[model samples]
Target chain A: MATALNKPDRTLDQRGLLCPLPVINTNKAIQELKPGQILEVLATDPGSKPDFDAWSKSRGHKILSVSQEQGPPKVFRFFIQRSG
Target chain B: MVLATEQLQEAAKQGFKKKLVIVVSKGTIDMLYPAFVLATTAPAMGIEVDLYFTFWGLRVLTKKGVKSAKIGAVGNPGIPMPNLMGVLPGMTAMTTKMMKKRIEKYWPSVPDMIKMIKESGGRIHACSPTMGFMGVDEKDLIPEVDDIVGASTFLGWASDPEAITLFI
Candidate 1:
């Protein structure tokens, strides 16, 4: 139940997309949320880790956490908060 | 003096919003993809992007060119085939088809990328001299082109201290 408290305001699924799409879509998706809202992104692009990190830093967004699942198709989960 | 130094530090912390100016001079499929990719991606990252298409690159902005753009295997060192083999009649077409297939599997088409760039507020500038040289009329260009400008105008934009300029 503790995890339920951290539910993001919006979730963007960028699975199967490649470099730049993940970051580009994230930028578009985040604009739909209010400042301080959290966006949960599910991306399969291995490059998303660094790309998202750099994108968030440049735009003044706060990346709360990131985790990766090791699978045949590895998935990266990022919880980013839109800065006020 | 201390106040001025503190203000300068604050400005640095805030960071300057840089513009991205990409000059695209080639019309091949391989060359155009990277140029459009960066042009689209930079705007998404909150950077203002201006794409200057000149010389052969101006063809890419034409309605006909976007549909007929092909990759040349003959002179491209990246192609695995020998130069002689690459000159075979269908080699360029085959190579172009193969490259498009590989690219489409994980990426958006060039047209779609251009749309994304425009939607994200990126500007596309066509070189006026190239337009005349290539006989590309304004009606021949895709609607996405924001302006038909000259070298001096593009250079002025690229001269911004906070601008990142690239020639592709």
Candidate 2:
């Protein structure tokens, strides 16, 4: 399915979490990935769109793509490529 | 005119100061969230943050108050007229409960936010005069409070040219 399309180096399931939690958890998760490694983040917070955009810009990470997955509870998927 | 030019030259040499100072004067649940939200966000953005809690806002520094902070729906402009049922005796508590449930969906609770601020190295200060007026001792405040200080001391920090100051 979604996993087969993009093979992420790390995937973080942040579903059911809120704003800063998703952002905070994403920060911790991304730190483990090496430079140029792809980190996939699954979050439910509506604020994640702006939060991820700002996070990517501030930390110089490249956002490969952001897609809203259709689910009973819609989820936001962020593909982030860590950049030094 | 010459002084302005020299100050600009010094600023260019030293880099712009990135600091935020916010004074929280109200302790209502609705009132306190903005301060916590901005305080935490600034640190996330690599900006130094200082929070000054005074008057009614001083309650937020207290363990009991922080744990049970209530929203005042009667006078709060954010909540509409139908919600003004808050003027009733038990309404504030009801409103607080409802707000907590809703806020949990998208944001951390007040106490959690405060903890996050402390963990992120944001400075929290209790107003000395207000503490004295309320007869609250240092032991009553949360462990996160860095200091109990007077207005002058906090004003000195906020007065920095590079500091963005807000009164919430």
Using TM-score as the measure, the top candidate is 1
**What DockQ does every candidate get?**
0.43, 0.16
Q: After superposition, how far is residue B162 of candidate 1 from its true place, in Å?
A: 0.7
Compose the digit string of candidate 1's lDDT tens values, residues B26-128: 9998899888888878876667899999998988899988777789988799987787899888999999999999998988887888888898889989999
For model 2, the superposed segments whose C-alpha errors exceed 4 Å read A1-5, A70-74, B1-17, B77-84
Candidate 1 Cα errors over 4 Å, as ranges: A1-6, B1-16
Clashes (N, CA, C under 3 Å) per candidate:
0, 0
- TM agreement with the true structure for every prediction: 0.91, 0.81
lDDT of 1 by residue, A1-84 (tens): 237327999999999999888898999899999998889999999788878876776677888889999975999999988989
| CA lDDT of each prediction against the hidden true structure | 0.85, 0.81
Worst 10 residues of 1 chain A by lDDT: A1-10
Residue B22, candidate 2: Cα error in Å is 1.6
Evaluate candidate 2 by giving its C-alpha RMSD to the native, one decimal: 5.8
Candidate 1 at residue A23, lDDT? Answer: 91
